[model samples]
Target: MKVFDIIIQAMLSLRSNLLRSWLTTMGVAVGVFSIIAVMTALQAIDRSVAAGLSSLGANTFEIQKYPAAFFGGHGRNRFINRPDITYEEGLAFKRLMQEEARNIGLKVSRSGNQATYRNRSTNPDVVMVGADENFTAANGFDIQQGRNLVEQDILYARNVILIGHEVYTTLFPQRSDPTEQLLRINDDVYRIIGILARKGAAFGQSQDNLVVIPITRYRAHIDSRQSVGITVEASSRSTYSSTLDQAVGAMRTARGLTIRQENDFELRTNESLVESFRDFRQTISIGAFIISFMALVTAGVGIMNIMLVSVTERTREIGIRKSIGAPGATILQQFLLEALFLSLTGGAIGIMAGTGAGNLIAIAFNLPPILPWLWIGIAIAVCSAIGISFGIFPAYKAASLDPVDALRAR
Candidate 1:
């Protein structure tokens, strides 16, 4: 028989058993759909996370009392016991590394504070950052208007502030120029020296909802607490590893750690953050694969049951074809093709549905949608293998029946 004739026959056989074909297809569809949707969503999340980490700048690392990304119950206690990284220590590090490092910045933050200008008041969720003059260069911040805080501003403990895009809009809506506007943080007046360029959102938080002030002024007048974090930037990408080593050494020495004592500080960068994310991703990937495998196994069993019924119902037709000089291989091929057709059709439908659903979820989360081509291709390939593997026993049973015996049995 011609290849086209076999295909037509297989399709016609499926049409005759419309309900059974659809039920079998649904099994495969459900299995593929579950896996594809998960994989696509994960890919989108990974992309968004990578972008967020890169926003911190290349060749940059932070020295902090506590870990940047941590989980579980002891996190609060960890913060409580960890020694505060003082501004004095940060200044000492800056002076020691001034010749080797490009820029070093000291930073502290206060959240859930309201800012007011005239009668306008901002939401209580604004972040107020106390950072040094080099914070703009070290943390990838750019001034959209006016000027950034300079060395003199830090030395003199000036009360000048740079506002984020969201803060600028909320507090100075009527004013055309924010440079001249005065913003009150908890009733403490600060002159706006600059407006920061919009940095969008990261990890579900708005990056442009902050107000930054000189560290000296912030410690003396506003917070009156020790430093929270210290950021250091390498002069060149090639020196990143060496720079990290130097910073760690300087921190250990400044903190008075002995050779045997473990260092209490944490050093983190974009690459390290990505590594942490990978650990989570790997766990999810394994779980997804196991779930998909189980679903496919169930679908394969359904295909086998349906194919057996098809062979039994078509006994007389098989006898007639074999009596007309059809070979056993031909009978086997026909049954296999029928099974393959059902699985491949189901696989296509599942892929389309999964992609649509996953992209919709990604859009809702304000992240870029992903297609997950690798997973889709793998699903198709596995479906084809399932068809051949599960169809074998039924095909063999039909092929082995003698023409006269099959005809006489009914």
Candidate 2:
């Protein structure tokens, strides 16, 4: 028989058993849906994270007490055992690296603050970040209005502050502009010297809902303990490697680390952050693939069982075809094609459903929608392989049946 004729016959066979075909297809659909949805969500998250990291500046590096991403489980003493990077230590490093580095920014953050403007109070979940004047330069932040923090502001620990776009909108909605609005942080009032340009969202969280103050004021007023992170920017790309070395060395010296002892602090650059995120994405992809494989395995078994039943029910038809000079290869090809069509149809539907659902969820969270085309292609190929491999035994069984015996059995 011609290939097209065989294909038509296979499709007709599947159409005749609509219920069984649908059930088999449902299994493949479920398997495809599981992985496709997960992959879509993961890709969306990765894109958002990458955008956020880029917003932190390409040549910037940060010194912190903890790593950017930690995967291993921590013991009970993890918290208490970790050493704190003190303000004095940060200052020492800043002084030591001043000659080599272009800019250094000290940062600290406080949460759960209520800002009030004569009764119009903001939500308590607002974040207040204390940073140095160099924060704008090192962190890729642009002022929308008024002016950014200056050297004198950091030196004298000024109460003046810069507000993010969200804060400005919420606190000064009535006014045409928020550059002149005075916001109250806790009990103290601060003039809004500048409004930050909108930086969009990251990891499903808004980046425009923060208030910026001088790090010196933050240390003295909010938290007197230690600095949380220090950002460093190199003057030239040529000095990037040496600058990192100098920064690490300076930090080690400040922390009083001996030759035998390892440095306690973590240093993260933009490239390192991207690498960490890529590693995380890869791990998630592997996990998703394993889960989807298990589901597909079950679906494959279901297909095999259904195909076996189909062969047994069509024994008389098989015998009739063989009696009419139909070859075993033709019978095998027809059955295999039927199985392939069922799986491919199911896979196509699942891809559409998964992508739609994933995009809806991303849209709800205000993130850009992502469709993993590479993964979708892989899913289609996997489904086709599953159908062919699982349907082989039953197709072979049908092809091997004796015409007279099959006719007699029916």
Candidate 3:
């Protein structure tokens, strides 16, 4: 009659039908895994996006030739055909927004560059950026040593450069001073004017594997035809909106767009980027939840079917117990406990497996290990509910059985 004794009985019953119990438990495990793995991966992506978005400074936005991202390929070709944001237009826009904005930077970038210092060379994956003096403030980069590029560097299109931390380490592994060191990229030899502070990886890509050169030099000696990206920073957060409007108007004027004509350039910012990611996360979450719900419903049905069979098989046992004065509530409690044990056991296995699987994605994204605690807690609660909801009917059926008829049955 003790609760512990009833608990022991419930566990014993499950042990006696180990194969059936395990099969039912697996159903529950699958359901939990479906949701947990998805959520874990999504959370990892969110973390990476949050970190990567910091690459753009506060109250800063970018104006480029195309949208930051395009999905489903619906209108991808339209963006491709849009005219490049010419270097001249970028300069004109900068001049127009100069008074309204705190700083305006014109930049262009090309990837797959190699930098050489003495005999040491960086991997060909290095990015070469053409930037103005305001690049560090407009972007979220800081010079750790030496000095930023001056107005004369851009004015005369000098062969001066700022090396990123990765380049610094790769080329100067001996801890030798990098300031004023001569380096070569392409056929152009340049002197390093500054050393950059390390900006850690974002979404598995190193942020410190590039070098910055004056936009003038980049256009003259580097890739002249490449589209330029303009970065504009607002003086204050309160003025960010007005600053963006002013920048947009300036860009429109620079591009010679009429009143009926649409602006040809794209506006990209950390806020817009985060909002896009949030929408993506929401869509994926909904899909995962639906799949998990279906799996859980199937698992619940499996639990109910197995419990019904258990009741039928134990009809004589139930009659004997009732004849000996065991209460219906006690029988119900034992059955419910058995179901709960099965569901919870499965959920534990699923949680561990899902976390491991999802973290594989996080590792690939270069993100740290993450535990989706909220999803885990929800899984536990859901398992408990499934067990009780599915097990109660069978328990009631067993408890209400007539002693005479149950004893007569085989």
Candidate 4:
């Protein structure tokens, strides 16, 4: 028989047992869906991490008490035991690196503080930061309105504050000028000096829910023991590497670390942050791959069993065809094609369902939808391989059947 005739016959056979065909395809679909959905979500997160580095301004690095991230959630106690980078030490480091760096910012932060403007209030999740004049230049914040914190603000420990876009919007919904307005953070009142530009959400949390005041005032009114984190910006991208190297030495000198002693403080940069996230993504991908492998293997076994049953049910038809001019090769070809068609159909459905489900995460986090083209291609190829691998034995059995015995079985 011609290949076209065999294909037509195979499709007709599947249609004859539509319910069984659909059920059998479901297993393959589920297997495909598991992998595709997980990969899609991971890829979306990967893109988000890269974009979120805008929080760390270009050519900027931070020196703090601990590393930016601790992968696998281990060794937290060991890092916490290290000494804090005191306010005195931060000032010394900034003075030491004054000539080498373009901008240097010192900060300490307290979260879960509410801001009140008249009777209006924000949720108790505002982050109040103690920052110096260089905070804007070093931390990627632009002044949307009013003047930014000047050197005098830090020199005298002024009560002047800079409110983020979200805080301003929450307190005054009418878009009125927030400068000179009294905004209360918990019990203390501060005069709003500037409004920071809007910075959208990162990791599902709004970056704009913030307030900044002079570091000295923060130390006086808030937690005095809190460690200071320092942000440093190079003059240009070309000077970033040299500045980063010099800043470490300057920090070590400021902390009075000898050549034999190990540095206690952590240094962080945008590149370092990306590397940390990459490790996290790899772990998740490995887990998804293992799960997908197991599911696909189970589904493949089910396909083989179903194909074997199909061949047995069609024995008489096979015998009748063999009794005439139909070749065994044609019977084998038809059975294989049927399995291939079934697998491909399931894969198609799975791809669409998985993509839609994964994109839901993007929508929730206000991130752009991502399509994993490489994974889709791999899914198609794997499905084809599974169809051929599992269908072989059943197709061979049907092709090798004895026409005389098959015809007499009824």
- Count of residue pairs whose backbone atoms collide, per candidate: 0, 0, 0, 0
Per-residue lDDT of candidate 2, residues 374-397 (tens digit): 989999999999999898998899
lDDT of 2: 0.84
Cα TM-score of candidate 3: 0.89
How far is each candidate from the true structure, as Cα RMSD in Å? 3.8, 3.0, 2.6, 2.6
Give the alpha carbon lDDT tens digit for every residue of 1-410 in model 4: 77788889999999999998898888888888888988888788777776677667778899998887764357788788888999999999988999998999999998999999999999998999999998988888899999999989988999999999999999999999989989999999999999999988765567799999999999988988999999998999999999999998999998999999988888888887887777877888888888878877887888889899998888998999999978999999999998888888888888888888888877777667889999999999999999999999999999999999889866
lDDT of 1 at 331: 87
Q: Clashes in candidate 1: how many? A: 0
Q: Which clashing pairs does model 2 show?
A: none
What is the C-alpha lDDT profile of model 1 across 1-410, one tens digit per residue? 88788788888988999998998988888888878888888788788787778777788899987666675454678666878888888888787788878988888998998999888899998999998889988988889999999989889988899999999888777647978668899978899999999887665467899999988888988777665688899999999999999998898877778999888888878876787778777888788788878888898899999999998899999999999998988888888988888888788888888888888877887778788999999989999998889888888988898999878756
Write the residue-wise lDDT of candidate 3 on 1-410 in tens digits: 79999999999999999999999999899989989998999888888887877767678899998776557467888888999999899889988987998888889999999999889999998999999998988887888999999899999999999999999999999878888879999778999989989998775678899999999999998779999999998999999999998888999999999999998889998877888888888889999899889999999999989999999999999889988999988998888888888889889988999999899988887777799999999999999999999988988888889988888879
Q: lDDT of each prediction vs. the true structure? A: 0.85, 0.84, 0.89, 0.89
TM-score per prediction, in order, is 0.82, 0.87, 0.89, 0.90
Off by over 4 Å in 3: 113-124, 155-157, 182-190, 201-205, 220-222
For model 4, the superposed segments whose C-alpha errors exceed 4 Å read 1-12, 15-19, 72-74, 201-205, 324-330, 363-366
Which pairs, if any, clash in model 1? none
Question: Best to worst by lDDT, what's the order?
Answer: 3, 4, 1, 2
Cα deviation of 250 in candidate 1 (Å)?
Answer: 1.6
